[model samples]
Target: MRPPIDSGTVLITGACSRIGRELARQLARRARTLVLVAHQKEPLEELRDELLASNPTLGVAVEKCDLSHPDEVDALLDSLHRHLIQVDVLVNNAEQGEFGLYEQQRWPHIHQMLRANVSAPMLLTHRLLRRMVERGRGGILNIGSGGGRLYIPGMAVYAGTRHFLEGFTESLRLELVGTGVVVTRVEPGPVAVDAHAPPSWMSISAVRCAREALEGFERASPLVYPGLAYRWMMRLVSLMPRPLMRATGMMAAKKLRQGTALLEERGQRVLLAGGPEALSR
Candidate 1:
């Protein structure tokens, strides 16, 4: 049987962003309370209002927290404690990624990403997983990336962090086998977030990604690849040799080093353009 998600108090980080926002919307009808956490308060307030309008009985708590900072994370936890809310499900959905050569990337950006992507989730899990184990029924859903499985010259630190999540989640699932606490990690490839940009056949909408993630979480899947095509692609990538993947990465790196690859910042996403037509656009 799948682990129960209904009537639970769920805490979701990156609550205002694409996947996190979709997760909140989908779970609002089933979850008793949704504790929304993000760096900004305004967006969370707006989303909170929208959710309540849809599900009047649903409880919503908006927390403004910069996950990169340790003190703010502590404050978030303290606030939840003061409110007497025991989280039954924890969704570590917040993330940071950079598309550039590792050495060329800003140290501050790298540091912040490490804290947000690695330390925050680890601390949150450590702080909350004990209670879940005690209760013997709970969930932890980690929103990671496909970068974890491949050799990417750029986004090295981000990929490393995701690899950590992949290992941590798999090992935690093993330890929690008989404890009844469901642990799952969703590695989404390309989730469609923009309406104006040209759509890719490989990209799935945020809603579909969230829906698939929840389905996998309920089934207690150790790892989940969101889109159908992306899922099959990841499976194939796993079957291939590491040297072959490295060779592909080297070819991309060659383009980047030779100035043929252009990294364009589109809204929240970083787009990598390879050819003349791509660069022209």
Candidate 2:
């Protein structure tokens, strides 16, 4: 069920960031051509250069497209068509998330997140999948989140989008079962980027996550939970009843609200003690 990797043309969105960059780096050695899509032009160019320096024969095309806009996504597709690059694999890795109470979140940001996390992927898939089906060989790798499985009070929209992806990818995989167009969803918990370390049990490095994700996609696995400890923990969580899961989420939400209240109190104390200047710092 493995889709063609070696000598394939792979298109990866958010190619300048952590997991996306790492996926590009790892895939460069095996993929014949790579279409690296990102919003930042400088970083995308830099990544393309780095990939070329290591593998001179590899074909790297840097595309600057903001996934928050449907027009930009369309333009990206048009550019690929003009360049005559037929993508053999697609990695939907770009996403946006805002952490706060849904009511407190700004509408613009929420809309951006909706477009980036949900609309863009769906549009890209709708546009590219038919060609893949006609070609009879391709792969789609969807980057999802653990939040899709659990309820979180602060990240309502973000979690909802992930849940959409979880269902979309699984259903798409079933539909494409014998088409040789593999579909896989990699659900990762919190990931560590740069020098910021994450809890050993709940997170993993972006590089490791990307590597495992690619491995899972190659095997055409319907779902992949990255990180050793996180995978086992999710397995345990999956066995819980819906009621217990909701209770656990409620407890976590309560703790978060308490923590926020404490922080607000501390800030208010500082403001009252030394005026607004003290709280500014």
Local distance difference test values of all predictions, in order: 0.85, 0.85
TM-score of decoy 1: 0.90
Which digits, one per residue and each the tens of the lDDT, describe model 2 over residues 1-281? 78777999999998988888999999999999999998899999999999999999999999999999999999999999999999999999988776655665678888988999999999999999999999889999998888788887767787899899998998999999888899999988767755235546666878788889999888888899998889998898888899998898899788767766787788732111211112222
- How close is every model to the real structure, measured as TM-score? 0.90, 0.90
For each candidate, C-alpha RMSD in Å? Answer: 4.6, 5.6
| Residue 28 in model 1: lDDT | 99
Instruction: Give a tens-digit lDDT track for model 1, residues 1-281.
Output: 45557999999999998889999999998999999999999999999999999999999999999999989999999999999989999999998776666766678988998999999999999898899889888899999888778777666787799899999988888998998799999998877665224436777888888999999999888899987889999999999998898899899778775552343332232333221112223
User: Cα lDDT of model 2 overall?
Assistant: 0.85
**Candidate 1: worst-modelled 10 consecutive residues by lDDT:** 272-281
